[model samples]
Target: MRFVSFRSGADEARLGVLEESRIHVLHPGSTLLGLLGDDGERLHEAGAAALRDPYDVLDLDETRLLPAVPAPPTVRDFMTFERHVEGTAKLAGPDGRVPAEWYEFPTFYFTNPYAVIGPHDDVPVPPGCTLFDLELEVAAVIGREGRDVRAEDAAGHIAGFCLLNDWSARDLQLTEMQIRLGPAKGKDTSLSLGGVFVTADELAPHRSGTAYDLEMTATINGEVLGTDKWSSMHFSYEEMVAHASRGTVVRPGDVLGSGTSGGGCLAELWGREGFDAHAPLGPGDVVTIAVEGLDSMTSRIVAYSDRGR
Candidate 1:
């Protein structure tokens, strides 16, 4: 089943299941965060009954779709793609090489949850940022609470999946990370979600052992960024969930980003194809991404209000 959070006119945020171009609205004022788990499997019934029989149906074009899990409890982005890591190393300079530690476990960084926005919303180009970028990736929304979960059992804790766009200020990120560590302001600018949450059973047919055989693509103003397979990830979503739960707790509404695909971001391309080959994102540039059944997401880059003369 596919679900989304939406709103029309002055009505409050509500849950809805997507069927083609129409949305089957669930209970009024029901947010996605409240229905993120299944019966016994986790908790919350996962809104199965309501999803099976919605309160009303409406044309999707008439209402505004919101982030699948608006205001997630917490968001953690993990580096699970080997090729992306290798490419990032190349961008570091001539002595670049993949770190051995990356092979041992999935590495991740916490990002801001308050900064997340809907798919159709505008992405602001942070003030003073010249190297604006977007990451085409997938994120797993945790369905239930778990601490120190095993990789083999992590799948049960995941409710569903959605596309994630980790918009970035590359120049700021690179400079700061070089001195201190991980990104903060560089990535807190904005984040985009697919807005449609796809249940695990719906995608089970496409499962390929450790990964899903889903084909993902991204485009910048109609130019393709190269299609990649979701199955190529060196670390699976379950593994990332397990690693994230090693010491702390991962609760429902928490999001787990699968990191950027090999060529999902401008940085990866600049690293693999040479820095001069492609340019950074700017105002008016539209970015879009799609992953099989997860529905597509598009965002237009808008200039910061304080910038320019």
Candidate 2:
């Protein structure tokens, strides 16, 4: 089942199950993560009950949606797409090359969960950011707690998936990387996630060998930027989760980003093409991403300014 978190009128953020263009509101003040924290069977029953006798129903377009997990406990973005890594290397300069270790295991970095924002929310362009860019990918939310999980058993711990846009400030990121670290300031400005969460069962039809074979695409200001299939990831979500669990606890509401798919971000495009070939994101640009079953997400670019400015 698909679920969404939204706020309407004077009410606080609330969870709801999506039924077509309408939302069957769940508890009056519950959160999406709170529901995910519950037992799977109980959550299903609650959703079913909500659908049958919704205390409130609202048109999907009428509410302001929040991120799928709203405030995830933690966020880890993995570099699982080999092609994207290779392509981005060219943009990294002459000595740029994909590290051999990347092929050995799925590598990831923790990102600020507080920076998370929903699809329809405006992404603020950080001050001094000139080469603002967007990374289009998929994100999974952890449902059950686990540690030292095996790849074969990791799938059960995932709650759902959603589209993720990892916004970046290329120049800042590049400068930091030159010192052998960081994608931090460049990335922490915002992390856009689709408000709608598609359960694993709902996307089972798109499952391929290890990853889903869903078609993912992104556009800027109505112009198509890139498109790729989720099946291209070298490491599966299961593998990534298993790797993440090595000597560490994976908790419910923690989000796992699939990293940028091949051709999914302008940085990769710049490497494949040339730096001068494309323009960076600027104020007023709208970035929209869509996956086969997960609903689309659109975010407008805005600048940090005074309240009345």
RMSD of each: 2.4, 1.6
Model 2 lDDT tens row, 164-213: 99999988998887887777798877888898988888898889976888
- Specify the highest-TM-score model's number: 2
The runs of at least 3 residues in candidate 1 whose Cα sits more than 4 Å from the true structure, single-residue gaps closed, are: 37-48, 306-309
> Can you give the TM-score per candidate against the true fold?
0.94, 0.96
In lDDT terms, which candidate is top?
A: 2
Task: Give the Å shift of residue 260 in candidate 2.
Answer: 0.5
Tell me which residue pairs clash in candidate 1. Answer: 37-46
Query: What are the per-residue Cα lDDT tens digits for candidate 1 across 149-224?
Result: 9999988888888999999999899888987787988998788987899877778889996679988898999899
Q: In model 1, what is the error at residue 217, expressed in angstroms?
A: 0.6
